[model samples]
Target: MQFLPQAPTDRHTTLEDLQGIVTGVTMVALSVQFLQAAELITGQIAGLSLVASYPTGLSFGLVFFLLNLPFYVFAILQIGWRFTLRTFLAVALLSALVELMPRAFSLSGVHPGAAAVLAGISAGVGLLVLFRHGATLGGVGILALWLQDRTTLRAGQVQLGFDLVVFTLALFLLPLATVLWSLLGAVILNVIILTNHRRDRYIASS
Candidate 1:
């Protein structure tokens, strides 16, 4: 199977990569701030970061970046060089954004409940944009989506299963009520994709 680079390339390859990198970093930085305030864990790689943030004093961006490194090999082997490069750019962007955004913008108090909903919406919108453009936030999510395409299992189920495990861990670490609320946010995120992320309508119109 062939995978196209999610973002368009320019005459200068460096420029194209730089664009992806910048996008990745910005999205992740905003994402982390939301996550931190909301106490909600996102799907896939971000979820892992949510768990890791507890034991490790490292920032979410650092943990998120390191955790995703192993998956780059999978992206390379399964997807191809173009995809790997795009994923690399995305990963780098997210790492940089998460680390730098807070310094640039001062974010104050947030209501965790509201933050969870807002974070879910923000993440879902950001991810949908990336996916529509032929890019992705690097994680096992890309692999999981591919697997679901090839197999009988649904992509939503795969993601939900992973999320459930992460939330369960969260429940143990935090409070059960928080876990439940976070799941609500996850549900909101998935709903946005399921309804609006389809290409068939756009393709037909075009």
Candidate 2:
């Protein structure tokens, strides 16, 4: 008897994939808490929330979650339900996690220089995980992906352009040295995304 070979299939997400998204967003939230404690901001929605929170005395978690709401419609229409739902969950969980992170640990001994670099590393790694899992932390990421699909530009480029605007705002709100370090963190985050998140290289459902 001849045996039949298996047909090609699109790999679906496993339980592990779901868990990774949660873990990744948690890392990102923790990183945001670090940035907040240092009174530094990075870029994109996270940075925007940071800037707003500093002035308004509102919670960054609340601001971040609210800021991401308008983009979910675009996200669903462009990326599909799985991606959108995962993004929503990640964003919501991140919002909650950020609130909890400060209470969970003390940052008194942490230096600004170290906090900035660690924030970048943790954020970059977390975002890398989210991207591979076919999800995002939402906000500008959804807009960037939508714009990239419509234009000749790459998503990374669109994100970087927006990040520059966020950093410029940081200049007014934070000390010059702090903004410079924040820029460094932004660069590290972009380097991670641009280098590792290639579509042709990593094929997964999105």
Which model scores highest in TM-score? 2
TM-score for every candidate vs. truth? 0.79, 0.88
lDDT per residue as tens, model 2, 63-176: 989999998998888778988998899998998888887777867666778888889889988988887777788987887666766777766677778899988877877889
- Cα lDDT computed for each candidate against the true fold: 0.67, 0.82
* Top-lDDT candidate index: 2
For every model shown, the clashing-pair count is 8, 0
Model 2 residue 77 lDDT score: 82
Question: What local lDDT score does residue 181 receive in model 1, on the 0 to 100 scale?
Answer: 73
